[model samples]
Target: MLRPQGAASKKVSVPPALKSSRGVKSWKEAAAWLRARGIEDIECITPDLAGVARGKMMPSSKFTSNTSLALPSALYRHTISGDYPDETESFRYEARDSDLKLEPDLSTLSVVPWETDPTAQVICDVVDTDGESVPYAPRNVLKNIVALYAERGWKPVVAPEIEFYLVAMNDDPDYPLRPPKGRSGRSILGGQSYSIAGINEFDELIDDIYHFSEKQGLEIDTLIHEEGPAQLEINLRHGDPVALADQVFLFKRTIREAALKHGIYATFMAKPMQRQPGSAMHIHQSVIDEATGKNIFSNADGTPSQEFFHFIGGMQKYVPSSLVMLAPYVNSYRRLTPDMACPVNNAWGYDNRTTAFRVPLSDPQARRVENRLPSSDANPYLALASSLAAGYLGIKKEIEPTEPTAETANEGSIDLPRGLLEAVALLEGEPDFLEVFGKEFIGIYAGVKRGEFETFMQVISPWEREFLLLNV
Candidate 1:
């Protein structure tokens, strides 16, 4: 899978070709306007549980005042391969191939910078012909999660810290050993991670990324050369979980598009390199009451709040099950190797890095739990939704987490599944992940993940090529 690497130092504004077309304040007017921009085509995109966009593009001339498109009602019912069965099997057993009405979500319209023709992008909601949200839509899944929180006068604020790398591929397999741009030597092209002095080596690449990102409104929170050679992480401010997920989807493409425009490649593989700290999307989560705007996790008498404990307890209680959604991809399991700043166990500690979850030493008013197990390969939508679901379970059951331990490494952290199969089993066995994410999502998700696992199983890797070619 192609993954993004490096923090876009900033997000650029919609380019000139896109400047006049901000949020589609009016889809009808915007559609008409786009039709006049010499646009020969428009593509409607729907993101799947895997965070991959899938949908059809249509000729611009045919779009009229009341244009409506039909997508597979089962579109919400499949894996990334477009490989789901009909009514005889799976989630939409009753619905079959019914059309899901496509209505434009105007804010999502943007210029497809890489497209050859005059093309614009639009994201749509999956609705039945009756115009109701598809029950299994990933977007709707988050909408439902948000509504659940709203009912309790709470808001779940989530922040995503993304890590990616810059790479260059060459025709000769050994050529990749050189710096991507051919600038290799005693120079620190891809040396030690975040060495303050060595950090200057890649300033040009980092500078261009930040500039491009600034113009795109990514609202970048922070950027740092992380603890990996040529690896970096970008932080975004806390936002509503649904929007945060969408941002992550767009953010992935933004970095990729920008990096390519600058002659570099970005990757988000959880453990791209063997001996370094793996990329992680550690989530710092907390809840605030919508009415008072006061953080419910804040302790009134100057101690850790009970509400806070319940939330962490909720997350910790079902983490093993949540791992299926939290770390969905096969490469995700590789990062669970002990002591790589990637977690092997499910332990939470105060200001500690070894634990699976952690409480930062930052101000108490800003206190939050850091979920450290999720790999860089995790999908933002599924990861966030599953987490909310598990945390809610924690609140409902009022579970208390065992105290954080002083043991180093994986001594006391909860064990994570070693592969996609185990992760799927974890999801299936735990009622929290199953019920919250729903059986349909579980089925589709497991199906796609299993497909990926199978693909990996069939392919022989370089190590195997060398180690077992003759022996096996």
Candidate 2:
């Protein structure tokens, strides 16, 4: 059992900002900051393709800027099931299986609030021996897209709305998960969208979430109950793409740890239960002029700008091809079905939830498009990169979007790929995404997904055994 410790579990008069090591630029400064906090261990980690934390844990005293930490280069080619793709022309295994160096990104350094021992964790960048970034690394792929915006003197700002479920613990893989009983000793029966009572049922766990987030320097915009039983949504404040992605990555870990402390499991699965609404990572995105610091989506007259429409045009044109990244898993397609509060078409509209892209009603400075297609299960880094890459392409090509559909987009024919294999094929054929995200990454990523899909095919579900055994 994990016990809460450190300043997070206890009251401290010192503000989190003063205690945080986020601003430190060098290892010497980071060491000073950790020492001040009496940190005993440091977790040097990086997000893999599936957003899984991978790297080394070491004593703080041994964690220097020059610490030679490295992971197998083939780690990037690993499937979520921990199996590597069969060697093929698309994904050839390196005979040497070289190592990729891990360099800490000091800005992400934060205290492990729930740890029994005083510990710190920092996100790392994967680099080769030459000190150049590994192109396929999830973080590096995002950096590549962000660099394109920087070259055009534009800064992309994004805020993600993450939705998840709190479910009862299930040790067996065959059994379906159910909502956990709250403080009232009863399980949630029906939808409780925005119900204060629903949130209060798990008040203690929610409080721990806030406490853990505060200690990690993550800014929470809001927390609200969603339509599903025990379903909750968290909105993060708008910020830089990489920074926000980092928060989303860490926030997942924080929420799961906090839930476990309460004897429940917090799942980010796109579709965790049957007949329940699927969870989504709705990303609200906009680009700003770096020089004027003005939202490029709105013109000087505060009216919608051409760039805004083109951005939507980009999404409409390219997002289908990028769906593999946004909806990465076989289960992810289960959530993309129509009339489930999930968008099946890449339609754009004004304050319309049915459309894939909704332009929310706000002041010109805050004008942005909310991409509703990404599943909660997606890797934050890759999701952001794919979404931004689509918009970048739209702007670069001046692609024009279709007329905004005020009617229900879910009523229309499904425009998205219906399965993982189909999505992979679409992504492989699209040259625009290939150029933006790199051909090497697309190849390895597609190959890994194909392997996972093959594995899934080998498994016989209960549905097949129950019905097919007697009928078919």
The true-versus-predicted C-alpha distance at residue 164 of model 2, in Å, is 0.4
How well is each residue in 29-146 modelled by candidate 1, as lDDT tens digits?
5655575566777777777777777777887655435578887655555554455533323324333666777776777666565566887667777777787877567777777777
- Tens digits of per-residue lDDT, candidate 2, 1-472, equal 5666653565667544446646476666787788788989999999999999999999998896467999998898888998888977777776799989999998888999999999999999999999998999999999999999999999999999999999999999799999999999999866799999999999999999999999888889999999999999999999999999999999999999999999999999999998899999999999999999999999999999999999999999999998999999999999999969899999999999999999999999999999999999999999999999999999999999999999888996899999999999999999877679887898889999998898899889888999999996
Alpha-carbon deviation at 415 in model 2, angstroms:
0.6
Worst 10 residues of 2 by lDDT: 14-23
**lDDT of each candidate versus the true structure:** 0.71, 0.93
Assess every candidate by TM-score: 0.84, 0.96
How many residue pairs clash in each candidate at the backbone level? Answer: 24, 0
Task: Quote model 1's TM-score.
Answer: 0.84
User: Candidate 2, after superposition: displacement of residue 448 in Å?
Assistant: 0.9
